[model samples]
Target: MRRPRSAVWLALRRNPVFYVAGLLVAVLIVMAAAPGLFTDADPSRCRLGLSREGPAEGAPFGYNLQGCDLYARTVYGARASVVVGVCATAAVVLLGGMIGMTAGYFGGWVDAVLSRVTDVFFGVPLLLGALVVLVAFPSGAAASPWETTAKVVLALAVLGWTTAARIMRAAVIQVKNTDYVNAALSLGSGHGRILTRHVLPNAVAPVLAWATIAVGTFIAVEATLSFVGIGLQPPVISWGTEISDAQAYVRQSPHMLVFPSAFLSVTVLAFVMLGDAVRTAMDPRERRA
Candidate 1:
């Protein structure tokens, strides 16, 4: 069932899921990059009288219980959410890839020890572990926005890298004995050069795909943490905080819950879909199946 490279590319183009997922992701990145292009209204501008106001002339998303324009808040919140997801994913990939690639390429005690460590870390739940770690950075006294962002990234990365490590390890093992790798090894190439020139380039595709999917998961986790009052706080308008603030008033103004929830879902779903598309495109097994 293996098709020509051109055929595979053509198939991907014909796949509706690819375009839909890619388009949605593109829109989100745009929103996150420059909310001004989409909406000029200040998200923080609020009025007591405007509280709970229904959709008006320009406010398609209506006003929140705080009388803030829901549309603007949602627009601005994308930046925080996207920023955290991207940053966290990059950290996870770097840490995970390094651990995995080394363990995979150099088997023996190193592999055994790293693998055991990975298992121990993997057994701990991401959310629970992150919450435990984040608890130390209490919201009281208000940690700086950058400091809070770093804490969340570190918490997630600590646990997140295990899977990435496993993937990288597996990939490296699969590629380490390939002809090119052997040739490089025979040429007196140093460990670093052999690894950089041969192993990683070949083994990194799958991990990249998985990391792409994990971005959505990371974003969702950030929202969950914020909802629980730990991740990002006031002065930093994230979708999670907005959702958390709106939950109490859900019954009165369902849009409060609906708007942020919708945005979060769409963002997460888009990334998941993009990941799926990338995996399918790159992984021949999926296409064969």
Candidate 2:
């Protein structure tokens, strides 16, 4: 008798980590989407009368020196972090997959050249490299938020893909030499056919797992940049910037730092846990569990 599809899903759902991660992600998605739902105050607007108020009846999370609601800022901040994380991860996966597949399949001078390029990026400090690129191109130069986001996405992607490329290259090399790939080649199949049909599919599993982990890494990088005043500038509220701004008044108004930092921490933890769950689920050893 065949097991029901629901049974399979039920078994997978029994993994506590996956459920926790899913709940966290769901909360973040909601926070990012309808930020106004969490608070009525405008994050950018300041009310002098309410400035620097501690957590109280009206303002539960308190107010910054400018009287901007901390809760609102943090909720909106989620949008920037989520957008950057998703976009950067996508850019890395696409570019890295192409480069890794080509180098691995062609293998020779092509592999050497690509490998060396990957090494160059790996040598650089990822966050610092991104900050330099971001600072070099002033936000004023960009026509719109979309333009600025595109540039940031590209910068992060360029730096982030080196690791992904290396992983994909290794996976491709192993998959290409497998029995099925050799069989395809023996049948006079074209390189393109063997790669797309027999090699890429098998090679991509590890890449998928890596990409999941990379989302959390990119989020942290974006946050670091924002904290240093190089990421998601004014009009774009990001958690890093919020936490950075809160640092000054952390002693007087700890809630300002607490709420935003909590959100960032939870979001990062969710992604990390999700990646771990995916890794375990994909592992052959775990299949028997």
Using lDDT as the measure, the top candidate is: 1
Clashing pairs in 1: none
Lowest summed lDDT over 10 consecutive residues: which window, candidate 2? 1-10
Model 1 alpha-carbon drift over 4 Å, by segment: 1-11, 139-142
Residue 66's lDDT within candidate 1 is: 83
Each candidate's TM vs. the true structure?
Answer: 0.94, 0.91
Stretches of candidate 2 off by over 4 Å are 1-11, 141-143, 286-289
User: lDDT score of model 1?
Assistant: 0.89
Prediction 1 TM-score vs. true: 0.94
Q: Over the stretch 1-289, how does candidate 1's per-residue lDDT look in tens digits? A: 4454655576568678889999999999999999999998999899979998878888999998789999999999999899889998999899989999989999999999999999999999998889888887565566787777778888888888888999999999999989989888888999999889888888998899898899999999999999998888887889999889888888888888898999999999999998888778776776666
Candidate lDDT values, in order: 0.89, 0.83
| Model 2 pairs in collision | none
